[model samples]
Target chain A: MKIAIDLNGGDRAPEEILKGCLEFLKNHPREKLILCTTKNEPDNLFDLNHPQITVEYFTHAVGMKETPAKSKKEKPDNTIEGTLRLVKNRKADCAFSCGNSGAIILNSVDVLGLKDPNTHPSLISFIPLYNRPPLAVFDVGALGNYVFNAELYFAVLHETVDIYTKLYGVKEPEIKLLNIGTESWKGTAEHKNIYRMMSDSLYNFTGNIEGDELLFTDASVIVTDGLTGNIVLKLLESFNVLLQNFRNFKDCKFDNNYLNFLIEDFNYETIGGAPLTGVNGKVVIGHGKSSSKAVRSALELCVKYAEI
Target chain B: MKIAIDLNGGDRAPEEILKGCLEFLKNHPREKLILCTTKNEPDNLFDLNHPQITVEYFTHAVGMKETPAKSKKEKPDNTIEGTLRLVKNRKADCAFSCGNSGAIILNSVDVLGLKDPNTHPSLISFIPLYNRPPLAVFDVGALGNYVFNAELYFAVLHETVDIYTKLYGVKEPEIKLLNIGTESWKGTAEHKNIYRMMSDSLYNFTGNIEGDELLFTDASVIVTDGLTGNIVLKLLESFNVLLQNFRNFKDCKFDNNYLNFLIEDFNYETIGGAPLTGVNGKVVIGHGKSSSKAVRSALELCVKYAEI
Candidate 1:
């Protein structure tokens, strides 16, 4: 199975992305690594004598600050759209990028197309709690206000969780709906109704899980709207600073690096990127500002899902 | 200034509530504590005979499970209603109850009236986190969804924080508008607009504080709907159990129960009894299943704010 990597994506672009492609080839030995990029200049990595790291070139690139639709329309020669095109044509099994998140999402939806009519896919993040593996949280910001298909919003999560369990080998990962309170009686009218609905025996449901129980507890999957989920995940990216403030308050001390490591573990990309599940095509999204390490993780995730 | 103690409210009504009341009265010395329940047929000294704990019979009692409106209509002689009548007649400066939360709200509105015309006072809970002093979260579920008054919403929390500072002797505690994330760009349309109104630089705005950071951190006042605030507080109640499970998963041993004192330091009542702040008159509403402890807390809360 072949997986395509975006060599000219994200802030660091070709260098970090290319470094990951080479590393993956060396580690796996048999897999073909397709590096899709725009030939802004031919002198850089064209001379690297690597047989496994195959290059497919376009002539333009998109800057991160540029609007997604603008970049898509203006930069037809951009590598992001070019790489995705390869996958749409069945030239690869999956596509990977540590690029502009907005651009990636826009392209993934507009180019790859939705998996089905009923399914509204979201950008899911796996956060690892203290004892449990990673728990999936979704629609981090796909839609705001948590309305329109609230039931189907949950139904898609049901399908996503079913896939996550089988893929992750979780014996019985408890699924908890993230809300304002643990009581079914708490939250807005919609949240209250959802809590009561989950109370039924249909799914192995735990009552509403609070946000504070997120990474420090045993809840496997905490579900919520994209607005809350996205912000929580983004704030998590800067948690190193937050940990020190916490340590001072507790009047205790721990390794600073350990704090970041533990916090990073909660953001499931520490394990690997998640397949944009329920999509028509195999699409994987990694951190837009991903390092070589993050790229490697996403590739491994792509490989694992491809085999599955 | 006198505060009527129900001596019967909360989870541990009368006993714990009574002890807390006596402790406060003893410390304050000058404050009058009116015990406003029917004298028992056979009672112990713990149930009677304090200099300030004067017995004033209400001729009736209320239970946790009784329907609020029905009980109020059927039992006009109830201690709760009697206490309200006392407040209205200026016979008592304020009334307190630990039992029948909804009953307290309904009766308080009917008897004393709202603090102002537009008032919809909310409950505020002071939760302690290591990173910061106990944060105050409001509206534990007093107001229903649809049409939240922005200025009144701020006033509810502004009054709550004012009380926190007065009681705790802290200056300028950081107030945060609880949101889905702490990012520069995040939150719902309503939350976003409210956040903008709050961010006018007139207040010590800390921007958005995500739900997850509400625990294990220091935040002085966290504002949200009663539904959301209670949800997080409830999880905090169950967090120790989850922590024990987390320890087991890591195969680590620690003194969990030994730290129960620190764990339970966040007394829900210190900032007890959600006052429908905007009402025309003073009204303190306690939890329906409030035991003695809750009753005492509500009494102390009202007694402190009796004049205001």
Candidate 2:
């Protein structure tokens, strides 16, 4: 499979990005890579002589602070646009970025387009739950409002779960709507409408699940509007940071090993990036401060997802 | 002050409930209590002959599973209704219950009525933050949808904060809307409208705050619709539960002391019951599974809040 990667993305940018690419190439010697970079003289660490790697230099790179839509419209030759064009032209199976997620989503949709115009692209990530298969949380930040139809949202979630089940050899996933209460009467009119739609649809719907259940429940797919999902995701992230700080405090009497183990579940670097699911083309976006390990894992995910 | 107590409330009703009241009475010998109970023969633990305590008998008790509105209407002599009536009649300065929160809220609203007919009562709880004053979270589960007016909600929150500032001797509290993003453009139209209203209003309105900031930000009050607030509150509760489980595991290497300290912050029992704010009467509702200690703390809170 041919995978395109943006070298100008992320906080560590070209250095970490090149190291990740090299790591992926080392593991999958048979696979090909289309590396997009804006630098005239690439970093010395990057092995330009790799036979399976191709370089496509761009004239500009999207800044982290620039508005995504505006930048995409004005800077036509930026890395995000350039890398997506490769996927658009069928030159690569998929594209991956450790850049500003907003830019990635805006450019991908504007360039590669959506699978269906009526459907919005959602950021899908796995939240590892102890003793159960990882729960899939979708639309973490892709769409801010409940703009899509409930039925369409369910269809996208079901399809994503189906893909996971097939790839990971897990059982058929049980879908649950994340709400304040497990009761049918809970949440807004939109939530109730979604619950009714899911209950009536062909998907294996297992009623409503509350936020507290996210850590312990057996539901494989937890669906929510992007706003709630983003808030929950970020809340969890910030909580993990607090735990880490507590573990590192000099006066803390806790055993560092156990604290590390407790925090392992919250580490995004371990699982790498989340995919922009439901888009017409494959795209993965990672954390801005991703380590080399996270970048490598993101590339591995790209390959694994591309095969499906 | 004559404080009303529900004798038949909570998971361990009458027993733990009475124990908590006794604990409170033992500490505050000057305070008066009017206790409501459906049981003809109260538990032996309750000091029925205490000079400061008076018992009120009722024929029926509200069960935990019954619908709040229906139960309040049908069971007029229930513990919640009886206790609230004492407050409505000015027979008690405040009321405390470790009962079904739904029943407490519904009964309080229907019986005592809100300070204003157009106003909705919100469940307000203090979330203790590290090295800072506790943050007040409103509408935790009181109003499920965004049915309350933005301006009225702000006015109520501002008044509550002002009262707290005067009583607690803290600085004027800053209020922020709990939202998906810090950006003014984020969240639903209702949220944006609230933002605008708050900005124009004569209150110390901070911009929108994300869930991740709940634990760390300096904002004294975080406001949101009940659905989102409930989810966020429960999510934090569950996260703390997970930490406790990890601490309890025999094989875990963490120091029990530090783990215990971390867990203490998440303990709802320590702070006792949350107030059903905006109601004309003072009502505090504790967890159903509250222990004697939680009950004691809740009574103490009732005394403190009543003084305001």
**What are the C-alpha RMSDs, in order, of all predicted structures?**
6.2, 3.4
lDDT score, candidate 2, position A91: 96
* Native contacts conserved, per model: 0.18, 0.45
Which regions in candidate 2 have their CA more than 4 angstroms from the true location? Answer: A11-31, A39-52, A63-68, A144-149, A249-260, B40-48, B144-149, B249-260
Candidate 1 local lDDT, A1-308, one digit each (tens): 68887777777777877776776677888777778877674576768867676778887776765666778888777677766787889888888776665677678777788777677767667655544556677656543233424665666766667667766777567778776544455456666666666676446677766655675556566766565566556555544333333334343333344443453453434644656655667777776567677777778778776676
Model 2 agreement with the true structure over A1-308: per-residue lDDT tens digits: 99898888888887888888888789898999998887664466455788988889898888765666777778788887778899889999889888867789888888888887766677888775554556788767654333435656765766577667865567778888888666676667778788888888746788888777787787777888667787787788777776775555454454455456557656566567788877778888887777787888888888887888
| CAPRI rating of model 2 | acceptable
- Which whole-number lDDT from 0 to 100 does residue A54 have in model 2? 89
- lDDT for residue B158 in candidate 1, whole number 0-100: 64
Indicate the worst ten consecutive residues by lDDT in candidate 2 chain A: A142-151
Model 1, C-alpha of B143: deviation from truth (Å):
4.8
